[model samples]
Target chain A: MAAVVEASRGERDNQDQELVQRALTRDPAAVAALVRRMAPVVHVRVARALSRRRVEARGRDLRADMEDMVQEVFAALFESDGRALRAWHPERGLSLENFVGLLAEREVVSILRSGRRNPWTEDPTLDTTLNELDTDQQSSAEGRVASRQRLDQLMDRLRERLSPLGLHYFRLLFVEERGVAEVAEETSSTTDALYAWRSRLGRLVKQLARELDDEEEVSDE
Target chain B: MSEDLPIRVAQRLREEDEALDPRLERLAMGALSPEALAELEADAARDPELARQVALFRPLSSELQDRLTEQMSAPVAKVIRPARWTRWGLPIVTLAAAALLLMTLRGPSALPSYAGRVEGGDVVLRGEPTPAAQGRRVMRGDSLLTLELSPATQVDGAVVARAYVRTPAGARAAPGVPEVDPSGAVRLRGVARELLGVASGTVSVALVVARPGALPEPDAAFAPSEGPRLEVQLLLR
Candidate 1:
């Protein structure tokens, strides 16, 4: 069954790559196909992200905002000689739809952040850590293999500290990279409750990090 | 100093991970067999990260799939209407009419010249033509516009084409995003109302084809330096 799934994915990847290649060359049919195929995925992702915001306060219909966002997402993909389209690496295990969906989420997050006066008040170090981790993943293969044991140990420690619900939140927000509203909906919780949980989790993770650092210091001494 | 530990842990986790498995995505969509799902869940039990992944995939995939199906099943007119003219209003009618008359008297040559290199290309105006054949081709208010790139000008890189309708009020981006047919011909349909707006007179439809970054800005002067461009004047009444 896994083999069948893998085979189907392979076939779909081939078709996606072909369509993307044609789109890169501005082939109208291929471009149209791509827009039609990815628009809904982008729209869903954007809408999910926007669900956290007060759309009513913004004085625009949610559908209208979603429509504009969808167009902007496509514009970004086709801009700069299709630079974003060319960045898709299916060999890395992400399908084109997922890739575009992820891009849409990031775009919406960026837009949301921009609307705020001080978006960085919630742990300015988090972005830096994410970027550093992303760089590590891209730049080192042997280092990654060597780090597997450490990663497993860390995960074990983190799991020990978290309750079952906290663990679920970790999985949804951090591991699966889902939007806050979607995670809240899945867990049958309100966004307010989820936000509280997220803040608590952040503090817990930081505390655990401090404990690990203390342990290392004691061992060194 | 303690803050550095989380970053270190994050780096290690990222390094240890490979890209997401496509099979997991299928499982999330409920396409996997019962046996396959059982096997996946068993594996997930040991791997907390994978377990978390499995937990979220089902809802995420289901939502996206449902939305995609809904959008695909929607009628074409309904889909196109909101997106094309969401920014336009009826207040521009008088200004657009005056602008059209001025452009009509100025002749087709009065349209901005393509200062950039012009490779051979053509903009074929589709729909029924009016009896007035003097200055520019007059078409009914509902004509579809077709843009065809000559075989010689089809280049190797990303060629992007954008259409703009120039009126006295200014240039409004034509509502219909161009779709290419199977034969490589680009078609912009259902844009007559958008291009004509509420005012009907002489409208200049400028089709700009260029490499992605070189495409002309909508409100700026229509001078591009990268690829072929075509302009056509239409009398819509």
Candidate 2:
């Protein structure tokens, strides 16, 4: 039974290699097959990323942007003499499919990361509102100053609450822009554990923000 | 050189894949030495289709991290603290605040509380299920409860880890979990009323996706960043 399974696995790997080789030659049929085969995988990754994005952004629609991300992944894989695809060395242990998948994952992560940074880019109306606010200098400047003060207060509170390790994690991740693996290694934790700790901290801070908002709302009322 | 990053990212991303299917935990954990990871990579290469599914989920993993940072570090975010009073005085003030909050939450609404029945066909939100509307009321009887997972993305190929409906009476596995297409629209036909014995009050619907595996318990509070689960509560009239 194990031998039968191994035989099938070898056969599948051979087929994958042929497809990728043909694809590298820019054979339209091979390229098309590659895309058709990979599209769902790409779409799913992009879709999942966007879905999480929609949630974090408070339920804004992100579907319209999905195609762009998927296309970017394909382009990266097939572009420049199929550099990305050619780089896949099955002999080294990863199959061609997984190699391409790596590309798709990277593309989706890049898109999600960028969207998180600006966010307004995902919705033009938000950008327009900010532009409008900028033109209204007197009120905007006053608002900015007030916002800065609030930020200072929030940071002070955060510093007080975070453990020394947590604070260092934050600084390394955000301020220094270190990767999760690097930070995890430095902290003597797995990436998953680091994620959980960070999430716990964020929830605490968000709760604090929520209470402040509630208090202000009551005062206004 | 740039290729190095994706490989590392892919190694890290197995964390999500493992969450969906514990069998992949070996890959998910960075426990593999470089040589071992390479062998695993070769194995993954043989199955591009599987690799793609696993890769697509990496974005969700990254998003979870992004969300944590976004929530806590946003400029002008505030943190509230109690006034500087005696410890006992603070507790008293906190108790007063808690009572006030409870009152506000349970306060009368424009819509009535769940009387234990939904009157109409299930209200479905396709492509993107929004958060449940609290004040919204539903009729109790003859209502078919349905949920649409939005941006159904990979649902067509996704293995349903577990799905069900729950209510005050009890919990039951849904007769049919969401059926999705390539367009990422999953339609779960409603048998929730029967399964949940949901004669009245509130019914909670939950859907969790994973690779094929043993059925897991339903998580009502599941969020995407928590892995692949969607949950919404409906208040019936």
Candidate 3:
């Protein structure tokens, strides 16, 4: 019985390692499996938080509503063809949770920007949205090999730090693709307030990644 | 930083990003300091997340290149927009003039988008014309012509061109901490051509005169220069 149990345990470890390897190779099947398993966690977290926001807004066009923002996040992540899913590279601090959080933060920022004009007094017409576009981002072939390795290591570290609650938030925001208003209405908060919370939570996730990077850096040194 | 870009290009990026839905242009010069560009390049190759971020920047860069090509297009200069007063006469004159050389706006409202060295002459494109009914006018010195834009007007080329304005950029924005901005000297650095690619055209003209408005100082976003006073032309899809 002991020998049989050992064999089973060894097999399980092998399976886990194989999954990790597949993910690193940017395999679509592996990526889809991972997304299916984790997307819901993101949805639940976003939904619960957004519900709180919906209650807070008595009725105001607050920019960066979580629910409104979440859908775009999933769409961008999953995209139409799903090319980006397989391309996800792990960085020192880019945990799956953190990656989702980064997407959330970026989405919110864009949302906030979409509605808000440049806040300059003198130049009311001054387009505040400067050159946000950086052209031609293809990396040189020379550095890609090392960069890919480093990125994979980073993703591994990032996935490990994701908490269940954080995972849920990602699923809510990324998978369910809920609007901030909808989330706020459910949670009894305003979209504006939800924006603040989303920002804060996203910040926390980044802090965790930073800590992870520090750990990795130390190990490397 | 990235490679050195033309002055018109720098100006356009400073002025237009989301407005002109552009494709990616791998920034070659000046947008990023060489060291920073190198550092980021290294990061991108190794970092998938970073790579994704880098990819996001492509469309914008491509737009810049396209704008430059449009700005420097000799072919466009040779073709002229037909004038309302005469049948084919206006276009032929403009095209003839342009094929010989790109019109130089002697006064303000000239093609101001070109960098390095540009000639002086004006192509007055004023008043509201019918949608897609192209017209061209020779620069009449002081009276800057305005191309009253019709929805979905795609006016390109010099002879067929209504007006050309190139606003030279000077100054720079603080590094990092992006803000919604157009005409940011810092961000633009030294753009050579800012092609105005307009989509779902509105009453806004693809090319317009800056009038007598004074440009801002080096520190100011709107500082004016004494040279040609053309604006960044808007191109339509």
lDDT string for model 1 (A102-206, tens) is 667656555544544212234333335446566767657545633443444455466555533455566566666677898777666788987887667667767
Instruction: Write the residue-wise lDDT of candidate 1 on B65-146 in tens digits.
Output: 2233233233332233123223433434453466468657763221111211111122233443322221255556644333
Q: For this target, which candidate reaches the highest lDDT against the unseen true structure?
A: 1
**Tens-place lDDT digits, model 2, residues B100-157:** 6765777522211100112133344334332232223344533445443333121223
Q: DockQ rank, highest first?
A: 1, 2, 3
Interface RMSD of 1: 18.9
- What is the TM-score ranking, best to worst? 1, 2, 3
lDDT of 2 by residue, A1-221 (tens): 00001112334456567767765665443443455445545656555555433423433434335544655566566656566677665544344545565556555555544545333355544335446566776886857644533443344344445533454554455445578787777656789977776566556556555565687699899
lDDT of 1 at B166: 79
- Residues B1-237, candidate 3: write the lDDT tens digits: 112111222232233333321211222112343454677778779975445334333222222222222222223212222111112245445644763453253322232231111111222334544322222322222221221111111112221112223223323321222111111100122111221211122112222222234323324322344432222222222
Q: Assign candidate 1 its CAPRI class.
A: incorrect
Error of 2 at B99 (Å): 74
Better of 1 and 3 by DockQ: 1
DockQ of each: 0.05, 0.02, 0.01
lDDT of 1 at B150: 27
